[model samples]
Target: MSRRQRAASLAQGLLVGMTLGYTAYRAVTLAVNARRFPRLDRPHAPLRQRPRVSLLTPARDEAHNVPKLLQGLLSQGADEVILLDDNSSDGTGDLARDLCRGVPGARVISGAPLPDGWSGKNWACQQLSQAASGEVLIFVDADVEWHAGALDAVLAELERSGADLLSCWPRQDVGSAGERLITPYIDLYLLTLLPYPAMRLPLVATATAVGQVMVFRRSSYDAVGGHQLVQGDVLEDVLFAKRLKARGYRVLGALGGERIGVRMYQDYASSVNGYAKSWLPVHGNSRLLLSVALAGQFCVYTLPWMLDFPGARLLRVTGLLERSAVAWTAGRRRPADLAEGLLGPIGPLLQLPVYHKAIRRKVKWKGRVYEQ
Candidate 1:
């Protein structure tokens, strides 16, 4: 090789070395702290009486998922359920009304029109809160199917922790490689950056949410001005969690593990489209920052595998050590290994196009299409 080529190779080797070292450090840190991740503590047999709990669901053209949700909430040990049908063209409104008709303390209301400066889900949630009378409000998405004791367990946690807000990151089910590669990235990002223990620290303010389920104290909800305070946010749940911390509230997040799980999208197209719908608004309209974020995700996730390729044999030695470290940090050997060594390379490739489309596409969200 020429002198310049030798120098370039050395530089690449050094880059790989630093990257692997950082990966190992993060992995070990994560594994050591893994025990701190939240778990659902089973309610004591003589269960502490929970406050009056309200199941607040915001639905829009969720007819397919609504039935399952209705069934799940009805079976939970809660005081009442309020389903806010957010102007569905499908039979969602009718289905909601019909399901609540004979069920005790169950009621459904058609949400008001979407006003200016308000994101759809937050607006719908505002309406749901207005109609709710329970002392504790549980925000559940229409897509989520809850188990019989889920609410009871969540309520128990809220009471025991004395937290103003409680949420859980449900286990995600992935059928296809697309789902596996893209879906878990969200979880990895969360666990890597917002480890449960760090979230309690005041300097920790990177907003994160398991929007599938969030339970809030009625007074705490009102104290932070509720959904109305966050109406303009596209990522309302994330914003709400941050706002709660900013306002001196104890915000607790649990690792759903297998307790709560949701199938977020049906297929690859749906998954891509779904993310595109909110990508730009969530990034504050800075495409440059968005590009940088995407690039960072790619490098961090894909670096290990690239090192293992035949042309990059030098990287395999470095990559394997780093992979071992990430595995340690995440608490599960297989997930961290696969995520860093295998999926890491492939995962970010899928995201680049999604970012491009998010910049160009006029997309539909919750039945309403918005032009970018």
Candidate 2:
């Protein structure tokens, strides 16, 4: 064969090897972990002595969402529910007070002014923490809705696992085509990349958390300095989990599945704007690492489909199957969502511009600039 033919053969062989290896690894690990990982979506026997549970939610212009959350919390059997109104231009505080009126153990607190060197969400959560009187503190976002018996299930799991901090991954409720196309990547990375079992090991610092729903023991939160330690971080959830693990506090993750759900963004524009704010921070704000990660995902998921080399079809099919399995396991696999996942690298490819925008500090969220 000519030198050109030899190079082509080498490249084809390498692609085939990578495709096969990744497919096998993904399929087996996902299958094994599916059974091993703890799920909070199921029912559990009631706790003998319910810990004094305090539910905290921070709202910023969440007038439309607060009512649903308040209604849900009323049924969760929490000892108290504290809502922090974070200087929303809209009448979120008034709406909350009106809805919570005459409701026992539920109150809305006006959030203090944002202090320098602190993110809005973090500062709000810290204020809520200070006023919380529960033994178990559950921090939830305004957009999250809890199913019946969700709080009991979480408390049961926390007791059984003996974890100081527990973060539950809510079932994502995607509305628009943009949401379906983009959001599965979050679960994809969590399921495939994170070594879930190793997170408990002191040697491995592979800490991660979903911010939508997190339960922390008040003692542990106080010991770890709570949100105050990560006050300036945009990705406070992940950083707080890491800090807890570093301090020898046991931290665990659970799949909320149907027990808890969140509508992350309404439409394409909102999705783009929301993700742009944290894409760079998620990758630790390192431009080099972001480039490598994006390039690597593109090569693995999209390059084979573009090539006309031998075994290209097999490579593409394997890639699609692996991604489909990931989506299915993550509870995000609908026909449309899976079809978008099959299109390969479109999601990560679309994120390139968002990453650049984030790097340039041009991303704004909730009327605030997150300039570095």
Candidate 3:
């Protein structure tokens, strides 16, 4: 073979070998942390007594979600179920009120106008907190549905963990082909890299939180200023956890398991917009830094299948198992999730367009445009 051709083959060989090594390390760590990820389904001692729990929901144009969400919240036996109608054009308020009407301790509150500096949901959440009378507060998104015994399970965990904030990453549900393609990425993305144990430490960098369901002690919420502290942050849940850590408070994370589920996006189109709003900011919006991170992901995940070599094939098989294992912990076991594991390369490729829009800071949600 010519010298140039030999050099090219060597470079490709090195890249494949490196990818295999990284994937191998990831596989081992995933196995080690598999059962370690907290599950809420197990039995536990309930909270000492009724703590006057409040379920606060912030919604805008979520007519489709109100029925399921409110139904679950009402049945959960919260002290109060308060939903803030954040200037929705849809008749979400009417639906919520009708569902909550005659149900003591459950009511819909009309949200005030959006303030200049605050984001819509944050403003709505701040108002919800101000209106709440519970000693424990849970900020739930309109998209999440709580399963039976969910509130009891949550309260048990809160008391057991002794954490001021317990962030529950719900079971991500995928139905459509587009949903299948992208929804599982979140669970896979976080579990593989984030140090699950370090999260227990009061360290800001290792802090993370899933926004869909966050349980907070009212005392701790007021101590740190609550959503008002992170009104402008696009990644509000994660930032709020970091704020708690910086203040020397404990923050715990757990898997929702069978307790709760959320379908954050209905299809591929919505998924792109949903992810684009926060990913670039997660990388601090530096193109160079984001590019490096994406490149590393591509090399580790997407490039293996494009090559013809023994190491490449081995990496692909092991990577599939790894992805599937993480997906199982997420309560994701479907034809779609199986495809997600086998087609691991598609995850990073799908992220490209979303990252592009994220860097430009152009996003629209619920008929509102945000250039921030």
Candidate 4:
């Protein structure tokens, strides 16, 4: 072969080797994490002494979603349930009040006007923190759904581990085609890459948290200054977790394990827009870094299918194995595991629009705009 052709062959071979090595490493990590990651699925026996628990929900224009959450919270037996209505254009406050009428320890609070340098959720959570009077504070998003004994599982895990913060990663229930196309990547990104077991150590750099469901000892919340420290931060959950670890506190990540789930958005527009709001900020707001990462995602998940040369099929097969490992670790059913993993190539391509929207450094969410 000519020198140019020989050089091209060598380059392709090198790329294949790197892809294979990385894919193998990802598979092993996924398996290890699947076993090591703490989970909130076990059924808990009645505790000898239950702590005073305050359940907090922050709602803005979520009248359609809050009813189910509030109803679930009533059965969970928290000492207090506080839902903050953050200036909703919809009748969220009224609806919440109507639902909680005559219920003991359940009430709705109207959020004060949004002030400068405070993001909407952070301000709302700060207000909730001030109103709570429990030994433990549990934050639940308005749209989250939990199974029977979900709260029991959370409290049990926190007590057993003796951790200050227990951040439960909700299992996503995707009903739309767009959701199926995008949601698995989020799962794969966390379950496959991060060493969640190391969270026991004070590694602020590895700190990650899901705000959908978080349980914090009231003392730790006060110590970390609550949401006040991460005011105006779009990615408040992660930032809060980092601060907790930096201050000699403990943060543990646990899977929902069928006990908790959330359907973040309903359709394509909502899905894309929802994710765009924090994608750039999550990557440190560096377009160059994010752009390179997106390109790398393309190469890892999509290129093997695009390439028609020999041995590309093997790459595709191994990619499926890696993706399946992630889906399994995320607790997907067998059929879902096969289907989502097979559709892996489409996810990376579909994420481009989210990345593009985020790179602009401006994103709108719940009728408010924020700079990344």
- Candidate 1 Cα outliers beyond 4 Å, as residue runs: 1-14, 41-47, 175-178, 204-207, 281-285, 303-342, 361-363, 369-372
lDDT of 4 by residue, 1-372 (tens): 999999999998887787777776777778788888877785656666789999999999999898888888888878999999999999999999999999999999999999999999999999999999999999999988877788888888888878888899887777777677776667787787677776777679877888898899999899878999899899998888888889888888888878887878887778888888888878887899889889777777789899866556876886667667676677676676557767767667788889989998578899999977
For model 1, the local distance difference test gives 0.71
Off by over 4 Å in 3: 1-18
Q: Write the per-residue lDDT of candidate 1 for residues 1-372, one digit (tens) a residue.
A: 999999998987776666556555566545644667665543324347758889999998999888888888888857889888888889998988888788898888888989998889989898888888899999998877777567666766677677788887665555565555455445555665555667667743644576778888999998777898788776677778887888788887775543465667777777887777767766776778788778755555566455452324544444344434434433334553355545444556877767978887466666676665
Superposed by TM-score, candidate 1 places the C-alpha of residue 169 at a distance from the truth, in angstroms, of 1.5
Cα lDDT of candidate 4 equals 0.84
Error of 2 at 153 (Å): 0.7
Model 3's TM-score against the true structure: 0.93
Relative to the true structure, how large is the alpha-carbon lDDT of every model?
A: 0.71, 0.80, 0.83, 0.84
The sequence of per-residue lDDT tens digits that candidate 2 reaches over residues 1-372 is 999999988987886787667756666677765766677776676788889999999999999898788888878979999999999999999999998899889999999989899999999999999999999999999999888888988999899879898998887777787666666566776777665676667742677888888899999999877899798888888888888788788888888776787888776667666777777778888878777777766767777767766666766776777667776676766786566656565555666666666667556778877765
Task: Return the lDDT, model 2, position 217.
Answer: 96
lDDT value, residue 24 of candidate 3:
73
For 1-372, candidate 3 gives per-residue lDDT tens digits of 999999998998787777777787777666655767777777777578778899999999999999999989999988899999998888999999999999989999999988887878888999999999999999999999998989999998888888899998888877688877766778876777675787786678988898899999999999988898898777798899888889988998888888888989999888888888888767876777788878977776677778667577786677567667888767777756765777676667877887777778566766766765
Q: After best superposition, candidate 2 residue 33: deviation in angstroms?
A: 3.0
After superposing candidate 4 on the true structure, give the runs of residues whose Cα lies further than 4 Å from its correct spot: 1-14, 44-48, 308-311, 321-324, 334-338
